[model samples]
Target chain A: MATISIEHASKSFGATEVLKDISLDVKDGEFLVLLGASGCGKSTLLNIIAGLEPIAEGTIRLDGEVVNDVHPKNRDIAMVFQSYALYPNMTVERNIAFGLEMRRISKAERKATVREVASMLQIEHLLARKPAQLSGGQRQRVAMGRALVRRPKIFLFDEPLSNLDAKLRGEMRTEIKKLHQSLKATMVYVTHDQIEAMTLADRIAIMKDGVIQQIGTPQEIYSKPANMYVAGFVGAPPMNFVEVDLVKQEDQFGVILPAVLKGEPKNYFLPLPDSKQLETRENTKIILGLRPEMITHNAFTQSTNPEIECDVDLLEPTGADTLCLIRLAGHPAKARVSPLFACDPGESMTFSVDMGRVCLFDGETEELIRL
Target chain B: MANPKTLPGANGKRYLFGRLFIWTLLLAAAVLYLGPIYVVLSTSLKDLAEIRAGALLDLPHELNFTAWREAWSSACIGVRCEGLRPYFLNSVIMSVPSVAISTLIGALSGYALSLFRFRGANIIFALMLFGCFIPFQIVILPMAQTLGYLGIANSITGLIVVHTIYGISFTTLFFRNYYVSVPQELVRAATMDGAGFFRIFWHIMLPLSVPIIVVSVIWQFTQVWNEFLFGASFTSGGSQPVTVALNNLINSTTSVKQYNVDMAAALIAAAPTLVVYIIAGRFFVRGLTAGAVKG
Candidate 1:
């Protein structure tokens, strides 16, 4: 019900800036995730939005009314912490009713609210149980129940599911998505987990250092990362950056892999589509971005591709799939292959670079090129 | 380390031997510590003449309640011979309130420091921590003058306040360190759930910090109860704590040495804390062990 705005916001610790000239908006009923690694100030920004931390310079507005100086309790926003921070002493029912009690709501209404929230979260049977009595997932539910009872205008989650085991984390992630869909509450979630960002966010704000690298839908960030940082950070087994020189091959500009593959120690040429119009540029140093999945277990050519025959240096089995690390064009690169592929060290595997999906980045600037 | 379950009867043998050794050492330590207390109790039931013979470890050949009656009613330390019970009562009134108030305030303050980030909070915590390390005697003169200014000098309330003030540092430190271990999320959850400062402190923080509070109470009680200098300096005979009365009764400058009566008064002064420790011994040990392990 509330749209949160951070207008020209900045935060600092002493002289070191944590968030610099940052501005973001959480539209009414939007699920916006501030996604970044630790120390990237995503949590700081979330805390700023929650009125938990003061900014060095910024005005935050909720629903167009400035809330820069509002105390957190009066801001009508509830937060679910990563730690599940359920009051250890209080039973689940009391924990849920705490907000209502704080507002001096009538006991009858508070009880009803607690019951409603508990059942909604599937924690009703746990009403009389203390936090210690509950499992991690149950504690998580209590934390959510504690927040949901208030019917706050905005919901802030600071990596709420980061504490759960993998299976539980996935379940809760789905539950959160479902909860968001049903309630349509304006939520600002901060997380380092890209999976959470991808699954839960309406828009993902990917940040680096103190600056945002990109802000867009999950598809946009994954498909069209603005920089090398985003390209690498948003993917697991990450995006491979092969050092290359852009050269002109005949009539078209081509990217030159700087080194050889296997016993043939020479460059392989791959031409670029020239929206860049620089496909014919000679010896242009750049990096080619290829996601591990894009370079697959299948044959190198369903279409004529930028193919490289490389030595599979290492293979990691993650039960679901195998991650093959290969030395291609003299640089270490990783590829996600199907578990059916029996990959081993010291063997050559032909990796198909999906030229259509490949990203070109300026070598020195690390900025993605349109080509 | 051999697997415990696979060790056959080794566990039972070990347990029995360990108990025997531990009990033996415990008995030795008990005798060593309570040796003086035993002498005091036994000799306090003897006449002055028997005490003069100083057969220190002997059972009193002749038993007498004369000393107990005299110590409670007629052992003159000053112009009044109405023994140390008045001072004993004064000490109880002082120590009990002092410990309770100081521990409660310290718990709340420590909870605040641990849970919240406010301007100058760290600096305030550092100052409070430093407050605990300074010798209590150093603050006695200024504290007395301040109490006098507030018109409570030489009063029990004055002593209680002073003791509570002095006790704040360790109590705060104890509570703060313990509260720090409590997950910050719980406090945040409580706050987000609309519980304000005092509500969070009482309902959320304090209830979860029981072991630390027990630890704090036991520590503060022992400290405040036995505080001789504060008791002696702050009040004269009528308002003095039992330590002062015990000192006056045992070490009277102008009176003949009455060992039996003196011992009886010492025993009386020591009784409350001894009784308290015995009653709450399990909690005290639990609190202390938990505090040490965590800290």
Candidate 2:
């Protein structure tokens, strides 16, 4: 219902800059997620948007109206904190209705809104209970109900599911997605968990050291990361990086990946897609990034995709897929394979490399090479 | 570690001896502390003749209400024969407002100091803490002059003002430490909920402040009720607190001495504080420890 535009936003604590000159635009009804590890300033960015923290320099516009000095409440936004910051002394009913009360709404109207939100969250039976009496998941639901009761133009969530257990985290993540879909409200969520960001965000902004590395759809970021940092940060058993020599032979550009097969050293040349950018970098070292799923036991249909035999160093079973750690160009790389086709430790396995989806990065800059 | 059943008999004997020694020391300390209360009670119930004839720790021959009545309504302090009655009322009037005003202000100050971030917050807190260590004697002359300038000198109002001002430092210290353990997110959420400063304090901060409130009330009440120097310095005659009256009752020049009346009046003055502690003693310990451990 509202769009957030942050232009040249910068913040610092003492001498250490926590948020550099950051510019981001969140479209109306778009679920934008700021994803990064701790100290990357994702939470600080959320606070700045919430008006809980002030920016050193820059202006924030909501719905194309300047609101740099406006208070958070007047900006028509509600935030769900990671701690579930429900008023410990108030009942679930009051906690949800408190905002309306603060705005001087009538008691009867407040009660009705509380009922509607409680039913939507399936927490009607818990309306009379205090926060102390609820479980972690129940408290999380109450927090969401409180935000929903306000029906603000935008909703801000700061790692709202981080305090829940893994199973509860998954359930609440789905609930949040459902809430966003049903309400079509603008949301800016901050989290360090990549899975949450991947499943929930319409567009993910991956940040590092106060600078945003990439902002794109989950598919775009996963398949085409802007830099080596975004590539490694977004995947589970994260994307593997191997240094290889890019060479041109017979008018074709490819990278030579040294591998160990059955205690013997070998080299596999995986051809790169035709690009003028690749031609200029021939006979030079480049970093090749490959996702685990891209290197699997299944054979590729295309003749261009190369297959390499590798010695499996370790096996990690994750229910449906077992990950086999293998050496690619003398660096340990993870390859995802079906549990049925997975090879045990100290055995040889052939993994087909999907050359079409591989990423090539500059050795010195660590930035992705366009192709 | 050896099991008790497998241990030697000498160890059992040593354990018994140790427990006996500990119990003896504990009992002795308890008697030493309670010994004065026994003397005061016994003396208050005795007539002058019996008090002269009996030992200090001796039990009264029979219960008597004469001295109690005399202390309540008819004893002479200075030139006043109104006993401790009016002075006790003066103390209640002075202490109640002083405790309430000081505690409420302290809670507000504490809430601001602990939760709100502003320029020079730490420096302000440091100054207030410095206020706690300032001796009453050091400020008496200046305070008296200020009270005179304000036209409340030598009255119960002046004493009330004095006690409240002096009590703020300790009460603020107690409440501020307690409020720090509360999460900062609660305030942020309340702010986002459209609750302003006073609204948040009334709904969120005050409700969660019961334990600390009890602590502050007990602390300020006891201090104000027992204070003697300010009560004596700032007030005279009809406006003097019970402590001043009790002093005059015991130390007044008289041939007979009236030991029973002095004992009864002293007990009457100390009774309110004793009762306050007995009722809220458990919470005092709990609140102190609760503030000690940071959340």
Candidate 3:
């Protein structure tokens, strides 16, 4: 296992900087995923960590040894590219054994290792076939097997499943997770697929415009995104932001939320949690972040939790949960309700907001105001 | 069902006639191209008296290897009459080393230009491509001077050096264009596998280079074999290649033009390239088309 520490790394191509002041430390055996959209420097960062690309600034350490000047082969790392990057001319057996052969391993030992890796990947039946003959899923497995057979100090994966179909992507994703679990090798995966990031990463580093926005556990990123970008980027049905005016209700502080009742828009006081940020921001505008699941189709009776009756502008049923779009404070927001909840478009319904899970951000800076 | 053949408005008949006519034209064209070769073969097999008396297309009354033997051993080339045999060997010696050395270095250089990202790499490749456009006539004077300075002027080694230098740009172009389609990930994968530059080229790049190699080999072979300018300009006498020898054999003033002997020598000079094309012709086309289409 290896611990990768990237300190203040920056990379510039010509005049444009692709990675700016990036620092990340991956613990031993932890599966860290660099997640971002295209041109966000996620792939560039992964290439830097793999030593495929050189860094213009800062140093990279693999297991406490500075490896910035080391050749990729000497870094003791193997990477699975998004394209699978299987040596096309070599058969599955030779492809797996090539690394061993290069290391001057004995012929018999290379064969045995290849056989073991082939069987582990369940590609033994395909050992004689070339890469062109394999299906997309099989190629992905072979790519993984190539990385696995080496058993390097670290494994780097650059969107290894992005080329597969949806069904195969899911299967290969689980296989990768299982492989990581069994081997417990330090893996740094890069992908823009948030679901892949969410399900596979021990810690997800959300990046944007060559900068790391936040690096934390998946749950931490989901529940407490550092800013508006992370909050909107991580979830499938992204977090909804509503412009609200903070007001004081005697000793209590809350926002005046617009709700629809009896086919008419009306104002309701949604009490904010008791916090210094809220008190300081009273009488000023702030952005409120709410997840789809945090608001559900439920009737509030005794609880003092904030609830609103709004018209369902649109309804989307996704087998397990039906997402109902409603307007809240002049912006469209998604509310996740059970599929059995009979909500129709243009009909009014009550959605209970979990006030404890709500996030408040400074109006101008867009950074979360933690209290 | 209708009687399809007779029930038609004669369109099927017209279609058959059209196809037949096209085939007839293709056959006529094929014969037109092969007609000269047939004459050369027939003439080379006949006695000089018969060749002079009979029409070019007439069949020889007696097929013989007399001219072939004379051309291979004792036909006159200039005053020596040592025939084209020594010059044939000279051409073989020159072409083989030229093709091998140029192709090897070209493949390595092409792999570097295609896969590696070093500073000035593209500038170097651009310079080499500029070599492809430098007409031989434009540099022959400088080349002769250089060869004389190196003490290889008028020598077989000088001819080999000239052909190799001239062949590199084409060979490099062939291999580079063909290898550009190869993914850089393969190199990265090899590098990660602890395979260094030469190791990667040997283990990975060379294995995948067969088609392009055949293309390069055939190209260099044909070019160096048929090359009269450099062979004639760089060397003379016994060191001259078979093409230069063939010209001298046909142009000798000491004897009457021995058409049969000259024809035999000409065919012998062209034999190796003919055999190469007939053997690896398909791969040549494949390489060309592969280079044409982008991945």
Candidate 4:
């Protein structure tokens, strides 16, 4: 296992910069994922680490030794491509042994290693078949087997499961997670699929516009996002934001939401928690970020937490939970409620807001407000 | 469309008539193509008296081997009575080595052009393609002088060099167009696997080149075998190819025109190319169409 440290790596094509001043470190035996949308340069960064693409202005180190000038084969790394990039002319056994053969390993050793990798990937029965004859999932297994036979210091996967169908993708994702667990090899995976990043990464580095926005554990990224982009990108039914004026209500600073129920408008007060950032900010506009699950149908206490009665504009039932859409402060907000709650459209329902889980952000800068 | 095998017997007459029309057209096309070849073969088997007595379309009363035997050993061309044997050997000696050397160089050049990126690569490819548009007659004089400078003038080696140089532009075009369809990722993957330039080419690229090689070989064989201008201008006597020898035999005014011997010698000169085309006909078409559409 190797620790990969990238220091201020920047890349550009012609005049347009594709990666700008990016720095990241992957610990030994750690599974780190670079997550972003298309053209965010995550794939380019992975290529740079794999020595497939050249870096413009920074140094990369593997296990504390500079590898800026090393070739990919000499870097002790193996890569699995998104297209499964299997050699079309070779049989599955030959494809797995190609790297070993290139390294000039003995024929007997190559055959034994091929058998071991095939059995590990459960592709032994497919040894005689060509890549074109295999199905999509089978091709993915052969690709992984080709990488695994080398047992390189690091494994680079470039969206290895994006080509499979939904069910197969999930299955392969779990299989990859298990493979990482058993082997404990350092792997740097690149993908635009957030669910893959959330499920498979030890740490997720969210990127946008060729810059790393945040690098944290999945739980940290999910519960305490660093910026507005991370908050909006990580969750499925994304976090809701409403513009509110911070006002002093009797002894506490809070915001009021205008809710409509039964053709009548009511003002509901949501008191801000005791934080140093909220001091001396009265009469100023701020944004309140709330997750969908935080606002639900359960009412815990009448006096401690704030509750709003609003008309449900839409309901989407996903069998496990139902997402209810309601209007708050003149914008659409989604709230996740249990399917047992049984709410519908055009009806008024009383929902409780989890005041402890709310996040406050600066309206102008879109940065999370914290003490 | 309905399945014809499952159709009723009552529809058989209409199907028969449609097939009959197609067969009639095909028969007319075949005769149109093969009529000249048939005349040459039949003429080569007849005596001078039979030629004067009968129409050109009439079959010989009795087949004669005298014309074939004479063409093989004793037909006269330019003060040499020794038939087409030597000139035929000269063409073979020229074509075999030329095709092999030109095809190897073409494969290497095509591999480099398709896979490697360097300054002015596209300009180089464009320049090579320009060679295809130049007519052979335009370069005959300058080429003869160049052969003289190389000290291979009027020799079989000189003809081989001339054929190889001219044939490279076409063979390179065929292989380059064909290799362009191979994915660049294969090369990248091979590089990452520690396979250098030549290893990847030998193991990965060459195995996949059988069809295009067949196409290149057949094309080069036909062109070099039939080439008369360069052979006549650049060489003399025993070094001239069969095409030039045949031309001299047909036009020689020193002896009475032996039409039977002339026809037999011409057919003998044309046999190798005909055999090549017949053997590699399918691969030739496949390689041509694939190179055109994909590249």
TM-score versus the correct structure, for each prediction: 0.89, 0.98, 0.94, 0.91
As for candidate 3, its clashing pairs are: none
Candidate 2 residue spans exceeding 4 A from truth: A298-301, B1-11, B291-295
Candidate 3 CAPRI grade: medium
Label model 2 with its docking quality class: medium
**Per-model DockQ:** 0.47, 0.59, 0.52, 0.33
Where is model 3 more than 4 Å wrong at Cα? A259-263, A299-302, B1-32, B291-295
> Could you give candidate 2's per-residue lDDT for residues A244-325 as a string of tens digits?
9999877889999998999888999888888999867878999999999889985534655788998998999999999999
Residue-level lDDT tens digits of model 3 in A231-336: 9999989999988899999798888888666668889888877887676677998998999988887753336667788889899999898999888877788999
Model 4 C-alpha lDDT per residue in residues B11-92, reported as the tens digit of each score = 6788889888999999999999999888899999999888877699888779997898888788888799888899899899
> Which residue pairs clash within candidate 2?
none
For DockQ, the strongest prediction is: 2
Candidate 1 lDDT over A1-371, as tens digits, reads 59988888999987889998998887889999989989998888888888778777978999999988888899999998887777666788887888888899999999988888888888889999888788889988888887899899999998888878999999999999999999989998999999899998999999888898899999999989999999999988689988887777676777776443465676667766756546344576778898988777655357666666666777888888788887666777788877777467777776666778889888889988875
Q: Mind giving the per-residue lDDT tens digits that candidate 4 earns over A148-267?
A: 999998999999999999999999999999999999999999999999999999999999989999999999898888888888999888899888888888988888877778868778
Best by TM-score: 2
Show the colliding residue pairs in model 1. A85-B185, A246-A284, A253-A279, A253-A280, A274-A277
* Candidate order (TM-score): 2, 3, 4, 1
Query: Which model is ahead, 2 or 4, in terms of lDDT?
Result: 2
* Alpha-carbon runs more than 4 Å astray in model 1: A258-262, A276-282, A297-325, A335-352, B1-31, B47-54, B61-64, B117-119, B133-144, B251-258, B291-295
For every model in order, what is the number of clashing pairs?
5, 0, 0, 0
**Which scores better on TM-score, 2 or 3?**
2
Second chain alone, TM-score for each candidate: 0.85, 0.95, 0.92, 0.90
Error of 1 at A102 (Å): 0.7
